[model samples]
Target: MLYLVGLGLADEKDITLRGLETVKKCSKVYMEAYTSLLSFGLSSTGKSALENLYGKSIIVADREMVEEKADDILSEAQSSDVAFLVVGDSFGATTHTDLVVRAKKLGVDVKVVHNASVMNAIGVCGLQLYRYGETISIPFFTETWRPDSFYEKIRRNRTLGLHTLCLLDIRVKEPSLESLCRGKREYEPPRYMTINTAIEQLLEIEQNRGESAYSEDTTCVGLARVGSEDQVIVAGSMKQLLTIDFGPPLHCLVIVGDVHPVEKEMLEFYTFGKSSNQIS
Candidate 1:
């Protein structure tokens, strides 16, 4: 049997009871490391923390192993129990869905253990889940490639009075350009897009498009290390949020569209101001 388990956004303790039970029973356990990251991360120490708690040795699966070498994992599942751990909910990223499909094709029985992900955890900021429109991912811009495809999506959401959730980019173990050119494996340092960089990039896109998709004064919510003990959430305008340091990796930005009365009231609690740097 193949089990796809979600280890919520925080630390190893965030694993659900069922997920913990499944992991404890699995003969082979693999942690998907490329999609989304947890607050504690997957460093050797972090991995040991999870192992010490769950009492299972976990194999770290990068993009190359999961995408190009998934058959090896699936084949192992064909005989004994295997558990694939994801930072967020199993299906939060499309890659996990592909894994399930592949497993099913191989006649492997699959079960999913769900947990909190940014999709629902963002509601801690007080925005109604139903009020959110199409979610978009903002990738890091390069010198030659600056894509603004999310601009139209955000504009449409705002037009319909719905919030837009911008999932920032996370690059982990990415091969360096020199390595790719030299046909050798050399990884660059992992980069997590900050809320400040995201806002700057958004403004740059607007400056180029000149379509008024969103302005510097537009209201937004910046979230960092969500679900963790030291999680920080700040509500403010795009320009205002830029001045606040969200601290640490794994940050996300929410573009406010039409704020309901309750949402406004909740947002008021964390609104950017003198005491805006409060941590939960």
Candidate 2:
């Protein structure tokens, strides 16, 4: 049997009881490392912590292993129980869905164990989940490539008075372009986008588009290290949030749309100089 288990959002201890049981029973366990990450990150120390708790050695599966060599993992599951762990919920990223499809094509039985992800955890800031429109991902903007396709989506959501959740990009084990052309793979250092950088990029895009989808003075929420003990949530204008230090990786941004009375009351707790700012 092949099991795709979610490790939740914060740390190794965040794994659900069912996921822990499945991990303990599996002969081989692989942790998917590209999509998202826990508070402990992908360091050797973090891996060892998880291994100690699960009582099984885990193979860290990078993008190449998962995307190029997935068949080997599925083949192993064909005869023995194998566990594939994900940072958030099993289906948070589309890649996991593809994995399940491939496993099924190979006639491998699969089971999914679900857990909380940033998709829902953002509610801690008091924004109603139902009020959010299509979520968008903000990728790192290079000098030659600065895509603004997500601008239209955010514009539409704002027009309808719905909030927009912007998931920051995470680049891990990415091969350098020059090295790829040289026929020898050379990986660049991992990068996790910060809320400040995301806002700066958004403002630049808006400046170029001149559509006014959002502005520096627009009300927004910056979240960092969410679901962890040191999680920080600050509610303010984009300009104000830019000056504040979020102090960690795995940050996300929320552009407020139509604020209902109840949401306003809840958001008051997180507004600048309020009690929620003292949470961490």
Candidate 3:
């Protein structure tokens, strides 16, 4: 059996009781680290923390291992019970879906364990989950590649008065361009996008497109370190949020649309200097 488990959003302890049981019984445990991350990150200490709890040696699977060399893991699962863990819910990223497809072709049974993810956790901003449109991911702008494909989706969502959740890019262990040409891989340091950077990039795209999809004065909510003890949430216009700093990584942004009265009240609690407008 192949078990794909979600580790939730906070820490090692966030693993569900069933997930813990699956991990303990699995022949091998692999943690997929590229999509999203937990509060402490996958540092040495964090890896050790998971090992201590699972009572199993955890293998850190990078993008190369998971995307480029997934066969190794699948092969192991074919003969024995192997656990592939992910941050957030099991289906949060499409990569996991592909893995399941491959496993099925090989006649390997797959089990998914769901947990909290940004898709649903964004509700903390008070926006109705059902009112959210198709979610979009914003990639880092490269010198020759500034894609605005997500802009159209955001526009459509706003036209229907539905909120748009932006999942920022996270580059982990990405190979340097020059090294790729040299036939030897040299990875660049991991980078986690912040709410500030995401906003700046969004505004830049709007300027070039001039589509009026969204403006600097448009309302937005910046969330950082979500599900952690030090999680920070600030609600304000895009222009206002640009000047504000949300420290730490694992950030997400929400483009507000036609909000309900209750959502307005709930958002007011995190709005700067607007305590009187607290949510009822």
Candidate 4:
């Protein structure tokens, strides 16, 4: 049996009781690291923390292992129970879904364990989940590759008066372009997009397209280290957020659209200079 377990957000303790039980029983456990992960879950101490709590040692699986070498894991699961752990809910990312499909085709029975993810935990900002439109991911802008494919989606959401959740890019265990050209693999330092950088890139895309989709003064909620005790939630204009510092990794931005009276009132609690709940 193959168990696709969710570790949830935050630290090691976010694992559900069922997920914990499943992990403890599995002969082999793999933690998918390239996607979202618990805060500090990759560091040596963090791994120890999870292993100690789950009562099982976890093998760190990078993007290559999960994508290219998934068969090796499935083959092992064919003989014994194995658990593939994800940071958030098990199926939050499409890659995991693909893995499940392959496991099914390989005759490996699979079970999913659900848990809180950014998709739902984001509601802590007080915005009604039903009011959100299609979520969009913002990739990091490069010198020659500034992709604006997501711009139209954002505009569509704003036109319909729906909130747009912008999931910032996360680069982990990525091969350097120079190294790829050199016919060798060299991983670059991990990068987690900051609210400041995401805002800058969004503004740049708006400038190039000359579309009034969103302005510098557009209200947005900047979130960092979400689902953690020290999570920061600051609501302000994109311009204002660009100035404020949202420390740490796993940051996300929410572009506010037509807001109901209640949402507006709730958002006030995180507004800078108004609410004491501002980021520390």
Candidate 5:
């Protein structure tokens, strides 16, 4: 049996009881480390902490291993119970779905254990989950490549008076372009986009596109280390949030659209200043 388990948002303790049981019963356990991360990250201490609790050694599965060598894991699962752990919900990323599909094609039995992800946890900021439109991911902008395709989606959401949840980019174990061309892989340091950088990039895109989708004065919410004990949530205009230090990674941005009176009242507690106006 192949078990795909979700570790939820924060840390090792976030795993469900059933997920822990599955991990304990599995002969081999692999933790998916590319898409999202826990508060402790993938450090040796963090991995060891989880290993001690689960009573099993975990193999850190990077993108290459998961994408290029998944068959090895599937083969192992064909004869023995194997566990694949994800940071969030099992289906939060498309990659996991593809893995399941491949496993099924190989006649392997697959089971999924669900858990909370940023998609639902973002509602803690007081924005109604039902009012959100299509969620968009904001990738890190490079000097040579700045994609603004998400701008149109945000614009459409705004036109419909629906909120937009912007998931920040997280680049882990990414191979450098220069080394890839040389037939040898050299990975760069991992990068997790901050709320400040995300806002700066959004403003630049708006300026270049000249679209009225959003502006510096637009009401937005900056969230950092969400789901953790020290999580920070600040609601304000994009300009106001730019000056605030979010402190640490795993940040996300919420572009407020049409707001209800109740949501406005709830968001007031997180506004940049007590005297600041409510979300518009």
Candidate 6:
């Protein structure tokens, strides 16, 4: 049996009871490391933390192993119990969906254990989940390849008076262009996009597109280290948010479209000001 388990958002202890059970029962357990991450990330200590809890050795599966060499994992699942762990809900990223598809094609039994992810956790801000439109991801901008495809999605969501969630980019173990040119794979250090960079890139894109999908004065919520004990959430205009520093990695941004009375009230609690700089 192949079990895809969610480790929630914060730490190793965030694994659900059922997920832990599945992990304990599996012969091999692999954590997907490229998507979202827990507080300690995939460091040796973090892996050991999960090991201590589940009492099973954990394997950190990088992008290459999961994407290019998924066959080995799938083949292992064909005969023995295997647990594939993800930081957020199992289905938070589309890559996990593809894994399920491949497993099913191979006639492997699959089970999914769900947990909290950014999609639902953002409700802490009081925005009605039902009022949200299609979520969009903002990738890091390159000088030669500045992509603004998500701008249209945000615009459409705003037009319908629905909120838009902007998932920031996380580049992990990415091969540098120079190494690729030399036909050798040399990975650059992992980088997580801060709310500040996302806003700057958004503004740059808007300048090129000449459209008002969003503006500097547009209201947004910046989240840093979400689900962690030191999680920080600040609500303010894009201009204000860009000036502030949302410490650490694994940040996400929310673009407000039409704020409800309750949402506005909740947002007022974390609104940008002297008090917001302090930890919540």
For every model in order, what is the number of clashing pairs?
Answer: 0, 0, 0, 0, 0, 0
Worst 10 residues of 2 by lDDT: 271-280
Candidate 6 structure, TM-score to reference: 0.96
CA deviation > 4 Å runs, candidate 4? 278-280
- TM-scores for all predictions: 0.97, 0.97, 0.95, 0.97, 0.96, 0.96
Residue ranges of candidate 2 with Cα displaced over 4 Å: 275-280
Which residue pairs in model 1 clash with each other? Answer: none
What is the per-residue lDDT of model 1 for residues 83-126, given as tens digits with 9 covering 90 to 100? 99999789988889999999999999999999999999999999
Best by lDDT, which number? 1
lDDT by residue (tens digit), candidate 6, 133-238: 9998999988788888888998899899888989999888899999999999999888889999999999988788877888999898888877878888888999
**Candidate 3 C-alpha lDDT tens digits along 148-219:** 999999999999999999999999888999999999999988898888889999999999999999999999
Query: Model 3: runs farther than 4 Å from truth?
Result: 38-41, 274-280
* Span of 10 residues, lowest total lDDT, candidate 5: 271-280
Q: Mind giving the per-residue lDDT tens digits that candidate 5 earns over 1-280?
A: 8999998888889899999999999999999989885345478998898999999899999878999999999999999999999997899899899999999999999999888898998988899999999999999998799998999999999999999999999998889999899989999898999999999999999999997899999999898877887788899999999998889778999999999999998888888975233232
lDDT of each: 0.91, 0.90, 0.87, 0.90, 0.90, 0.87
After TM-score superposition, the amount by which residue 148's alpha carbon in candidate 6 deviates from its true location, in angstroms, is 0.9
Shift in Å, residue 94, candidate 4: 1.5
* Candidate 2 structure, TM-score to reference: 0.97
What's model 4's overall lDDT? Answer: 0.90
Greater TM-score among 2 and 5 belongs to 2
lDDT of 6 at 214: 83
Model 6 Cα displacement at 227 (Å)? 1.4
Model 5 vs. true fold: TM: 0.96
Global lDDT of model 5: 0.90
Residue 181, candidate 3: C-alpha displacement in angstroms: 2.2
Candidate 2 lDDT, 110-195, residue by residue in tens? 99999999999898888999999999999999989999899999999999999999999999889999999999999988889999
Per-residue lDDT value at 102 in model 1? 95
